[model samples]
Target: MTGALQADLPIYDVRRPVLRLRPAKAWRHFQNLMKDKENTEEVFHIFESLPWRNLRPSAERFLRSARGQALRMREPNLPAILDDHAALRQMPAGSLAHAYCDFMEREGLTAQGLVEEFDRFAKHHVQFQDQFRWYLNRMRDVHDMLHVLTGYGRDALGESCVLAFTYSQQPSPAHLFIGYMAGLNIRRQVRSDAPVLKAVTEGKRLGKACPRLCEQSITELLPLPLEEVRRKLNITPAMHYREAHRTWAEMGVDPYDLLGKKLQKAA
Candidate 1:
């Protein structure tokens, strides 16, 4: 019998799964700690205090510096940031809130779910400016994703902790230190052990892992599926895949399946 093999058949399912959790008592403990009355009060106080409210210009300056470094390294492009802003603009005013509700319902998060609650607040309160809205949106989206990638939970304590870790790894010490201080304040409110300090110190010792994860996990895993979604959703800039691939590679990452080939070639 003459057999026809479908040469283009997919060999592996490449869909990026939604965030998954590895059961850790530590996570539960952290959650419980955040719910204590004193902790909750402190967190609420910090939110209302607006210590950094007047620091918008400073924040913008820091972000611009970070963006400059990222661009110099060619690890990220402005187009993706622009696209993210466009997506946000296209979304209904409450679309993110609705999405958070749906995500929470589907994921079985309770009303007390810290991350879900924060998402609700972020979606509602985050403002958009005509010029820098795109960058801000990109930062907001990636901040959540970073939490997922770094195994940070969504509670006030968890986010504060991860922000410290992020600060340690970012190229700018000033940015990191500022965030670290904020995290310290939150940690004090939560009455949590100064874990953020440890995270930052450890991050400095271990180096940033996200760039590598982006190369090995996100780049290799997301491209085909993201492309499929783009096609199905009629998204533009099909070149985004190529741009992301090149950007990561330029940042000393090897996103190609060639493994050590690029390293050897570089040498």
Candidate 2:
């Protein structure tokens, strides 16, 4: 919100693009992803190919303003920092870096894996300015970090919830469409739509309450405890997703996996 904090922010402003994007292709890919629910490649394709022509102009002022440049300067060398566990471990216990390291270890994930995936995608698919690509790459890199910060798991429901939160924060139409479609799929298969709806609604609420994370300096935030980071960002708990995970676990079922099963059958 503050122009001073936003100047150097590398967050994409959805302004006019020099590239000719294919919205239809993006839409089709999105539909396929919704049906399969496992084709992560399609997810990248959708975002990469989708025409943001109608969406970027609105955010252009903030994205290109002098303030945004300042924010960008404060942006962290995330790939470098996250790649070294020793560096991450040196941070405070409750810091974002600490939480990220813990999450990666607990989930058997690696920062390198995320980086490799994005690099591979960029090498073949993304063709844009270095600055634009930097912005996109940063978004791709921080995505899972956001999931951790927002208290969303890597489950089907969690993905929807995160997307919902994203739309609220950036109001990107592509994110909204993905969230909406995912919610619909879960609603049709699951006996109860309450959890699905609640996740989305709560995400929207959290997005509204929080500052634009895209403008924040990740390097500065990583050394602070998770609670402190959340406080600074105005991020509240994602109660709906948490409760749903608990309920489904208590029922002796992995709700996330079940959603995928139902989707496969429908497909």
Candidate 3:
């Protein structure tokens, strides 16, 4: 699979910014954190260190396209609002903010928890071209919103699905690496690849149907009805993750515990 993905490596011009990604290092961290999800800070470092400049070029192209220019012009004042997750949680139901909050709470996550994680990573080291900064910041802040919009949970399989969606939309090796590697681990534990494969396929399908989410003005979308937001973004409901979760529950197999036990057996 890795060989096939490598065969499809994108060839950009020499002038494009190089992200200097270290896949082996990132993969090692990915394996370690599977057994200990609490080490989310390490996962952040893995992603941060492997910056994929896919967004920078994609945004530039989108800005010049006819439909994209309109999107850029109408781009709402969103930075301040996107950074305020607590306030967003208090927003009315059916709104993007409300949906985001509900997804976080349902998944046993907190915005502040993720924010502190980012701060811990950023405080020590963060660097990028001025051109990529805006897009990168928006991507980092709106991650949970993607989970809500895509109807994916924060569980192991859910995260893989989201990463699959990201890879489809963004064309990043970082996302592909994480998604593929995690999917492999999950398949190994479950001894069945069907669930993970289905979730990833659904994610890729959704990504293709939707526009570039990173460029969307969250301020404009946040207050709109959730169904309307989905319509505008061309997003559809995802069911594979929910079904997979149910199967796992019925089998009494905790995904995380299974992962840890598998790692112990392997060691």
Top TM-score prediction, candidate number: 2
For residue 97, model 1's alpha carbon misses the true position, in angstroms, by 19
Give me the displacement of residue 111 in model 1, in angstroms. 17
- Predicted structure 2: lDDT: 0.70
Write the residue-wise lDDT of candidate 3 on 133-229 in tens digits. Answer: 4444546666677888887767677788888787777767667677767777788778643477787778878878887677777767888889899
- Predicted candidate 1 versus true structure: per-residue lDDT over 1-267, tens digit per residue: 001122232222234122222224323433444455224333323332322232344434533564433422342332232224344344444333333333435445433344344445456453322222323323333444344334344543344445444443333333344345545555454332334455444433332433322212222222233334234323233132233335545655443321354568789
Per-model TM-score versus the true fold? 0.31, 0.78, 0.74
What RMSD, rounded to one decimal, does every model reach?
21.3, 5.6, 8.6
The Cα local distance difference test for each model comes to 0.36, 0.70, 0.68
Pairs with backbone N, CA or C atoms under 3 Å apart (clashes), candidate 3: none
Runs with alpha carbons beyond 4 Å of true place in candidate 3:
1-17, 48-50, 61-80, 83-92, 106-112, 126-131, 192-194, 254-267
The prediction achieving the highest lDDT against the true structure is: 2
Error of 3 at 118 (Å): 2.5
TM-score for candidate 3, residues paired by index: 0.74
Provide the lDDT at 138 for model 1. 31
